[model samples]
Target: MLALFKSLPDDGSYNVGDKLIGESAAEFIDDITDERVVSYYDVDELLEDIDLINESKALLIAAFGIRSSIWRPKLADAIVDGSIGVPVVPLASAWSDFPGDYEQLTSENYPQYDRSVVQFYQYVAKHAPAVSSRDYYTQKALEGLDISSRMVGDCAWYDLESLGEKMCKPEKIDKLVVTDPHQSQYFDQAESLMSELGGMFPDAEKLFCTHGDPSQSPKRQELASNANKYGFEKKDVSGDVSNISFYSDCDLHVGYRVHGHVGFLRKRRPSVLLCEDGRGLGFTETLGGCGFPAFTRRVPEASSTPKKILQTFPEGTIHQLQRKYLGGDRVSHPTTPARDDVVDQVTDFIHQELTTGWHRYEMIPAVIDETYEREMKPFIREISNI
Candidate 1:
């Protein structure tokens, strides 16, 4: 199974892929019982009187199929220096370099138009820990306006009950799982977001609520959706999985939250995750921890590719461009792993972990051998128990 840590941008714009996370988490739980995929905030929430370290080791399956090793020391330094308290690890595939091939960043085919952008990049140093002290550098951020939180109240368009029945159908449905719960007990944002989502995917047969949210609130703000405003109501579910597994035959699953996406992959699904990239915020960990195909929230406009200019790189050569993303808004910077790298690492780790432990699939290659499987078997089994 793959891991996803990307978050949806609060803007109602076209970040429609966030739904993959919500679906993946549910699929994972359905496949494996013991563990739950979660955000760091989830880790923190489980710390009250629960055997955090033990339960963490027990119920805590690796997120994005990523372990602490890849980012630990570096993450430790971030914490030591107070730049960040923790770092996220992605569930990468067993690839040392970029997979297949890619085209170079261009203004045409890969075009990006910032005509609407008032700032150079909306997200700055996307992963720097929030600073308690508002210093000069952070103060500079006051010059900009952030509207991500605005998307919180908008999930009313993505109602779940209507989605569930649609998903359990016989035919396949290409779905995007949005894992933003508006009134979740811990995150405090699960309920409203889930409401809006319940109204979004009209074709979905099943919309499972990973975290339960009650349907009662006296005074709540409503988030308007450009999609719904443009006229998009979430489809209702009807057929059962027995009729034909629409969800089982999914082509892609993408989301902002990590757990839900992992659930999808654990059940053997393909997915893409939307990065919750921000300026001087948590985008780093959010994206870093993602295991599957992760795209940036800062998409360029169609104007950037008026006629579609295009460029292609050799297979596995996409990763050489990490330097470009490090200093700015692109992916694959010197200081940071390329988007391709992030996907590779997490996928590699999980494939290796699962291959040796469970029954093998010859068609699907296994990255982990028997020895590695034996060692991690306990941890892997723990989640199933939970």
Candidate 2:
């Protein structure tokens, strides 16, 4: 049998992002159970050891990102079958419409575009008592499907204990970290920005962190080969805890991955996230004054790239760039600031924190605390009783 709790290598060679997801879920379970035993499993192993799993008080899982067609049926089956005699709870989860939209989906059209999203939630509504999502988008999606869920921010937001006192900008910028995405256009753009960032922090140690395995993906291999072109010392992390700990010493982070941004923020350090998709943007919607959008609200014109958009900064207003690049007007989110305002806030965050050596902290850290008090603690108590 697989070990209930697996230990990750600390040497920083581990690169598969799945380990990050599993480790994140474990962190929450550890926090929730306090003294209870918590074992981790991949979806396949999870199904294989149902009898052993049934021995536990509950099966708390994390499905924090978009689910492909492949995982839809399996996850739904596991939740329904596993929860027959025990409760199954999900944390910091979301149903994103990446690669496609879920807004116009119906039972008839869902199968064409991963209808498993609806099926998965259908099982959740019937089996799980309650579930928490990472964004309002997921809540709205579930609500549209008649499945109720709570938007408690990302589960990773709860990883830190005290926020009020710990929420601080580094007194001095010593280390600067940057992350590149797998997408070719974005990768090129991030690489180009390294020189500009280097000039901004001449003395600070620059590091490039890769969240995915270069050995597996051709794009990652390209990223690895090109990473050294900039002055970045590459550090590959293996698990979620390692990723978080890896960034603990860093003064500031500018990255394309959402979790990298989350890891840095969870450590109470300053960071910025460059949105790759709706997941990053939507997750940021819950962050109050934090988060930025790299592209416009709609499909960007072929002439507009992240590089072009970024090049306009410090001179052209975001609104001006939007018009110049033919990027659409900002879409209003019900809860958080629009994309233009967020970009302005994050711009101030970088400049204020970098130049003045400290920026005034905002609502996110306190919001995470409030979320824990109102949502997580109550959920833990309710799940414990069951």
State the C-alpha lDDT per candidate: 0.27, 0.58
Clashes of 1: 97
Give lDDT tens digits, candidate 2, residues 80-189: 56542566666656664432222323334332324665576566667776777767766665666666777766666656454544666676678888876633445555
* Regions of candidate 1 where Cα sits further than 4 Å from its true position: 1-176, 180-251, 277-372, 378-386
Error of 1 at 112 (Å): 32
Model 2 segments more than 4 A misplaced: 1-21, 64-72, 80-84, 99-117, 160-164, 297-349, 355-360
TM-score per model over all chains = 0.27, 0.74
